[model samples]
Each structure stands twice: as C-alpha cells, then as structure tokens.
Target: MSTATLINLVRNGGYQVRRRAVLTSRLLQDEKRPTAACYSSTSERRASRFDPDGSGRPTTWDTFGIWDNRIDEPILLPPSIKYGKPIPKVSLANVGCASHIGKRKENEDRFDYAQLTEDILYFAVYDGHGGAAAADFCDKYMEKYIKEFLAEEENLENVLNKAFLEINKAYERHAHLSADATLMNSGTTATVALLRDGIELVVASVGDSRALLCRKGKAMKLTIDHTPERKEEKDRIRKCGGFVAWNSLGQPHVNGRLAMTRSIGDLDLKNSGVIAQPETKRVQVKKGLLNRDSNIRTKGHHRYLMQVALPT
Candidate 1:
C-alpha cells in the first residue's frame, strides 16, 4: 500500500480525528478493537461523573474542563507513513496570563500541529493582542488552513507563505463581518516552525515570542524578534506612519503599548502601516552538527539533538 493509503488506513483504524464529518459506523468498526467498547464505556462514565451539576450525563461543552477530553480530540497525523523509519515526535507546553492593564483578557495563545507527514511536523504559536477574537480564531482555524495548504504544496517555503496569507485573509474576513467594529482592531503575533526529519528546522515570526535552537551547548535564535526599538523596525514603523514612543529605559513601543514591529491581526496597527506579517528563516540542524563534528565537541551537543528529536 502507498504511504498515504497506509496512513488513511491507520486513521480509519482509529488513530486520527475525522474532520470532514462525524466518523461513520463502518469507519469506526474498522478502527475499533474489542477493547474499544470497554474503554469508551469507562471514558463515558468518567466524563459523566465530572459533570458540574452532578448529573449522570455530560454535554460536549462540559467535557472541556476534564483532562480525558483530549483522548477524543482529533489527532493530526502525517499523510504519509514512514516505513522502517520512526515517526518524529513533538511535545509543547504554553502558559498565558492576562495583562495587568486590560479590563478584559484580550491575549490568547495557542500551539498546534498543522501537518504531520512522515518527514515533517508543522506547528505554530500565535499570541493575540488588542482582543481575544483574533487570537481565538487563529487558535481554532490556523491548523485547518495549514493542512489544506500542505495538501497541495510540496515546497516548505511556498507552504509557509501560503499558510500565512491564508491566516491573514481568514482574520480579515472575520473582522469585516463585524462592520469594522471592536474585533477589527485586534491582532496577533505569530511564530511557526517546520521540523523536517530531525535534519532541518525552519521558522517564521512576527512580533515577539521566539524559537531558539540549542546545539552543542550554544544557543542560536531561529527567528528575529521584530521589536519597535530596533533601528530597522523603528524606521519601518515610521515610514508606515506609526510612531515609536520611547520609555525611560530607552525601549521603543507602538503607542506606548506593544514592543514588536510586526504581527497578524491588528487592523488598527496595520492601518498605520505596521504589518503583523512574519519574516521567515530556515536552518539545517544536521548541517550545523556536521560542521562542528569533532571529537572534542561538548556533551551538550548530543543532549541537545536528542532533546530536539524527541518531543517534550
């Protein structure tokens, strides 16, 4: 069988989430093992017991508060299955807190895998500002965009640009539906990574929130932070009709609020010519390692590669 077909078979066998529609009986039965019935029953009972009202039944919304809900959540896997090659794994953790000045918590952050093929794992992190609408939308819809884009793309560079543009359009459409009201003013900062076969890592970023590559005890930044105070960023902001205000510490900010010079969702900022669009960078991890391939290399190099190869 082809790799794609094998992956589809595995997904049909219960390894993936069905996005187009609810899983049909035939699909479920093909995937289900005898133990699935017992596991499902236990899961249902657990969910019921955790229902807020103490009822024996739990609604779909109620499942959000429980950890077990992840089990039923859709799993994104690569279209191709690696034969004799182990699938690369990735793990991520994120924490977001409300800003001290805001009455409403407008910032939202998410890390999700958009595509998982045998050779590549595509993931992105979006940090929203101004309001939660843009960020929340990114969290919900960016992955879908990535998957759709990748299905038709073979080059990583083209895929990155296409996905980003799609995200931009999606945000704009969502904003326009509100008659150019509150949500339109909101925007997000994005940083994305494409991990390829433990050999190459490509990253793109707009605003802050960074991706770092640690190899052989040395740390290297994968993407530049687009801060307003930087000379280039400052010039760009000014040329775009945005003013960079400086603080006592000599740090620059846009409207005395944000520090970054680029982002995704800020329509108000974009109007001033400060784009939220990200700059992209690609790095070859294996190439770097090969360049420093020496017996005298520190133990940290091995540790770093091992850490990167295995998900958190």
Candidate 2:
C-alpha cells in the first residue's frame, strides 16, 4: 500500500488491478488521507510509464531524452575547416526531455545540433508551438544550413544570420503543398550560443526560449527575451494587427497566446506580417590587465588565459 511498493508494482506492470481496487476501496471507505496518497502514487506511476526500471534512463518517449547517451559520441570535424594554432580542448553535452505536463505523444521542443571549436562552442534550443512539423523540420535542416553557410561565408556573424534566413525560406517552400499545411502555422523559439576564444560569447535568439551563460562564477544572460509586453515588442505586434494581453500571472503575451515576439515558421502569424527573426548579440571576455580593469574578475590568472583556438 506504500508509494514505493505501488511504484514497483506499476513498473512491473503487475499492479493495475490491485491499484484500482485499492483506490476504489479507499474512496468507498471515505478515507481522505489514504485516498490522497493513493492518488499521488497513481500519478507517479503514470509519469514513470516510459521508464519502467526507474533507473532515470530516458526512453524514446521522452523527447528531450534523445541527447542523453549520445553525448559520448566522438567529435567529427569537416575536412575543409582548418584548425587554428594552439587548439583548445573541447567537450559538449546536451539533454532534451519532454515537458511533464500537457498532452502526451508530442514534443514541442527540438534540438538539432551541438558543435564545439577551439574558439567557439555552438548549441541551439528550439521550442516549437502549434505543432511538431516546423520544429521537426528545423531539427533536421537547421544544422545543414549552418554548415553550408559556414563553408561559403568567412564571417561568423554573417554566416549565422544567413543560416536562419535560409531555414525560413526552406520552411516556406515546404509549406506550399496542401499536404504540409500543418507546417504553415507551426513555429518554434530558437536560442543559440557561440562561445568565442573560450572567452567572448555571442547569443542569438527568437521567441521566448532562453539561453543563460555562466561566466566568472556568475550567471550572465546573453540574449533578451522578445516578449509582447516590452514596448518594442508591443509596437511590432500592434503594427501587425496583433494584440497583446496579460495572463493570470500578469505576463503579457502575443495575441493573448504566445509570449515571444519573433520565431521561425508560424506561417499564419507571418502572413499577418509578424516575421520571426533571431536577435543576435556578442559578449567579449576580456583578459590580462583589462580583465581586472573591466570588473571581469576570475578565480585564477592562468585559468583565465586563452588555452588555444581550434581551427574551424
């Protein structure tokens, strides 16, 4: 009758009838305390349906779980990209898990790629809204666009911008067919980080999904949340004939629905002139005497020094 015992029984798929009987008996007995605990145990069992072993090992049911074990894969570099002198050691980790709440079977969030260089580490988080079509498409094609842009473009900033634009165009192309109509209204929030020289960092974002940079023993945000409550965001929404409304929590949102002002895809919103484009910003990690002067203190001097810049 204990929670742990009930969980074990559920995981082994042997307690469904017993669990129902216990709940029914508790309800009929009018036992409030026992009934509440029974309901709580039932909820826990339902939540753990995918991981019957209770090992915290993610199954395919957990959308964000896709990256859990795959982070161990060896890094493969493109032959065309050259490594810079004094290459820095690099490592990357990513994990995406489905939201515990909301309807099951749909993973609104998508992550496409993770890349690291001597000078930069790139990662992206995409939160899809409306449906999975646009999000899945971005998950499939966004990295390819970035790689291709990098191949032809030298400047990192320009390459990143063009990559996003190309992704938008590709989504639009796919949306032309009636069969792919779901993609027309589906969109996602994107947040990306580019760590440069292991010191300077650049973050680009669209919509409300966030990116946080922990630097110098403190959490520093690199990108602003483009929400409808902000004056600029509100103005843009109004210009597109969209209205903003506050939620029960007093948070302003676009058309009383979405919180972000920009996103990729969401063809229905875009058709109303609300184009979703990423906002990009760069941060410099100063070193040497400049570090002390700029208030960018560090734990150790040697640790703050640039180790190496890997060739791209």
Candidate 3:
C-alpha cells in the first residue's frame, strides 16, 4: 500500500490549535484582554510551546499564555491501529511545524491535520485576510464539518465542497449573532486534503493556499489559486456586477476588494461572485511509487513540511 504524508503552510504563519470549534466564541472574546492578562498564570514564566527545549513544559491549555490557541502536540488519531486497520502512520519525530509573526501584529494563518477515521487522514491550511477571525473560524470548524459530512458521504470531493459552503454560512451566522459587522468582511483561503485507505488522495481548495506533492524528485501542484487571474473566476465576478481592480502592488482583487475569487466567511463579498465552493482534485497513490523518497508540502504565508515513509 502507498503511504501519504501532509504538510501545511499558512501565508502569514502556521500553528496548530488543539482545541475544538466550540471554543471559538470564548477565544475571540478573550482577545480583548491585556497581553499580561491573557496568560492563565502569573507566577512562573512558561516556556514557549514551540520551543525545542523540554524544560518548563506547559501543563495546561494556558501554556502559551496567549490569546491564540497554539498547541505543540498534534491531535492524534483514534485507536484504529489497535482495531487492525491498515493506515498510514505519521511519526511525531518526522513531522514538524514553524511560524513567524512577520510584519503583521499577529499571525493570521492557521493549519492542522488529524486522522478523521480509521481509513482517512485529514490535512488543511487556512489564510486569513482582513482579520484572523475568518481564518480562525475555518481552522476550528473545517475539519469538524468534513468529519460530520463524511458520516453520510462517500465521496471526498463532495464532502469537502459541502464543508466549505457550510462553514461559510455558519461563519456568517456566527458574525451576525456576535453583532460584529466588521466580521462580515473577514475572509480566508482554505486548502484541505484527505488521504484514505493509505492510497486515495483528494484535495479541495479555495483561494491561493497551495498543496504540492513531491514524488521521484519531481514536484506536482495539486490545487490552483482562485483569483481574478483565472478567466472563469474573473468572468464570474464580472457577471455578478463585481469589477476586478489592481492595487499599487499590481495584484488583482475582486471588486477592488478580496484577492481571491472564492473564500470562506467573506459574507460581504457573496453577492460579488466570491463563493466558498472549492475546486477539487483526486489522485490514487500507487504502492512503492510513493515512499520515504516522497514528501508533501503546502503553503500560504508560512511553510509546514511533512515527510512520508512507506514500506516497499
């Protein structure tokens, strides 16, 4: 059987959030507190969760002592291995993640991966623009939505498509309830991939975050950027009475606004042809063709790298 690995790269920076989607409300509200007050403890200084040093490890979710839901460990797969299911094993030692704040005040990108079912591995990267709220929303709920849809759907592409649209709608409702009009403008790019039965690979994406597969020393792109640069996307925007305008940076944006034609949580741009429907691609992994010599890398703002090891 072929083994697949995943790497997530966020445009601004990429970090893992171990918390569930239900915490979105509380987490957003907590952002208003002072930097010091954000920390859960005031006594001893806690080491950074990403630090390689083993000293001063955090004992609770408050370990980061920051408003962001950053966690060092990956959310692990369920006990499917014990049930005798043949699935690809991702080694903690071989998987690593990194992020940088850049010139921005905070990282607006989010990425994560998990084993959704005994036969499925999930990976995703989200890039937030206007605000991190949209990115944060997608980060927390995208997987959950996919998992839920998977229970009734057999097609990965269909599941991903539904997940994106549903998440966008949910974010709109969330913003409305919060009474935050600004959130209506918040939006994010989503790139999600699923590996099932250690061979079937399906990827769905909206916006520009990209997924690349490296096999036999050659790199293959798995998704396209959903921007005005694409003829169909630009045409859709114009048909919806939206104009594509270029900024001083020479980048094309929809309606003189969002750079990507499709995204999640850009409720304000919905009428302008910016929809959350994702373009999907499916590939079948051949045994021995994808092994330790192969790797998968995804990018948004920052890069997350993954290495794969498959037995011959």
Candidate 4:
C-alpha cells in the first residue's frame, strides 16, 4: 500500500476535489470526551450498553488548576481577530472564527493559525477524543516541530510528513517519552495547511476533519477522512487483530471504539492498527484569492466535522 499519495491538483486537474456526500456530525462524535472517543461517558453508553469494547495527554496549561481535567472551556474567538494585514489593498481580507458548545458539556474542538513570516503561514484544526488534551497538546506543540523540520534538505512534502509523524510519536504513549500523551484513553484528529508566498498550499491530515475550498463555484476537498469503514483501514485493523463493525444503528466502529482510524493519542488502540501517520498533499496556486482567503471553513454551528447524532 502507498505510505502517502501526493499530487499537484492545480496542475493535474483544474481544482477538482473528491466529491463525497456524508454527514460531518458523525465525525464529531469520535471526539466525545470521558474515555471512549465515541458516545458520551454516560448518555451514549447507557443508550448502547450492549456494545462491544475499544477505547489527550496533559499540558502545562493544566497547571493553572482551576478546572476539571475532564471538561474544558470552548475556544470562543472574538470579532477582533477578523482584522489583519492584507497582501494587496485591493484584495485584502479579514479572518473570523467562533466556537459554540451547543448541547455538549465541553468543547473538544480546537484550532489555531499563525503567521510565521510575511511570506509563510500555518493553520490547523484539531478534533479531540476521550479528552481535550490531545487537541491541546498538538495545538500548542506541532508547529514547533514543523518549524524545526522546515530546515530540511529535501522538499516541502517530506518536511510536513516528518513533522506530523514526529509529533504523533511524541504524544502517543507518553509514558515512554513526553508528559503530554499520558492521556491513554484520548486522541485527536488534525488537519493542517501551510501557505507560502501567497501561492503555494500544502495540507496534511489524520482522520476526517476535512479541508474544503470553494474556487470559482467549485467545491474542492483537500483531505480524506481516515474513518474505520475505509477498506484499507479496515484491512489493517483486522490484520492487527482489531475488528471493525457497525453498531446496531449502522455506525462503523473500530474494535467497537473510535469512528476514525487515524489520530494522535488513543494509546489503547495503537496496537490494534491505529496510527498517527497523516496524509499529505500539495497544491500550486498559480493564481487565486490569496489576499482574502481563509485557511478553512466549518459548516453550521457544530463545525463541519462534528457529528449531529449517534446510534442508540
């Protein structure tokens, strides 16, 4: 099997994206906190007590100690962030983001974007499972590795792939190396993109939080969901002695645990064929709205990748 697939979408094709119709809501449930990535610690389980088995680390931020380790506050962005430096006055744009708790007790979705320099930028979205620690850890530290790996002698693709893997290893089973991945029962999906000189776009992701681009009235999907139902993922899981099956209501689960097959953290499932390796892709944007474009967009209030309901 291919370890990774790379293509220049702008050159190979115009800007066509994989067109798949599915629910983003289903994706979010995998990040549900309190042990299993899917289902609430109480609600989803009592609703499905007849289900099989399966199942973040900590951060310096936890030192504040004013919070419950299990539940966390949602990242609520202010309107002030909508303003920033624009490339050209004619094409300048603003960025805006907001997070909503909705019916969930705490927000497991986390995101961050940083401008490395006048010509470079990085943006990432993380949907956390089991707990918010995985998202929090990756959100704070992945960029450090990305910057460190950028001094590489190879190319952008190699640099990004390695950077993602480095952090995955750093956070997975932290009982061995770092203090962050100790959240043995948690995991998080990452979708990251790097923009350079306003024309080059690079994206890497694990799990299903998607990256979508609307170009000239076309919806372009830049990432793939590493969900359990994917054939390759299923085969790998089974080969590793993990079983993939649908719950009574038709939701696919790996070893009856997580919905997505790839993510950072989730130490218990690593031996069962789960991995933190990400899918990396590059795009050359010879021409596009660089001055005003945002890194990614979420749909509705639940965010594009969040699940609306689970099988009972």
TM-scores across all candidates? 0.57, 0.58, 0.68, 0.62
Reference-based lDDT, each prediction: 0.59, 0.59, 0.75, 0.64
Clashing pairs in 1: 13-31, 78-116, 187-265, 187-266, 188-265, 263-276
Off by over 4 Å in 4: 1-93, 173-182, 286-295, 298-312
Worst 10 residues of 1 by lDDT: 293-302
Q: Per-residue lDDT tens digits of candidate 1, residues 124-240?
A: 666666676776787788667766777898766667777777787878888887774988777777777776754456677777766666655566666667887578888877787
Model 4 Cα shift for residue 102 (angstroms): 3.7
Candidate 3 vs candidate 4: which has greater lDDT? Answer: 3
Ranking of all predicted structures according to lDDT, beginning with the best and ending with the worst: 3, 4, 2, 1
Backbone clashes, each candidate: 6, 7, 4, 6
Residue-level lDDT of model 4, residues 129-149, one tens digit each, is 788888888989888888888
Error of 2 at 113 (Å): 3.0
Residue 245 CA displacement from its true place in model 1, Å = 1.4
Per-residue lDDT of model 2, residues 202-246, tens digit only: 667777665554445465655677777668878878887888889
Across residues 1-312, which tens digit of lDDT does each residue of candidate 3 receive? 223223333322334342444466566665664455354656644556554233333345444434243323332234324423233444424544566667888788888888798778887788888989999998888889998999999999999999988998899889999977889889988988898766678999998888887666687889898989999999999999899999999999988888899999888889999999999999865432124325566777554333333333
Error of 4 at 178 (Å): 8.4
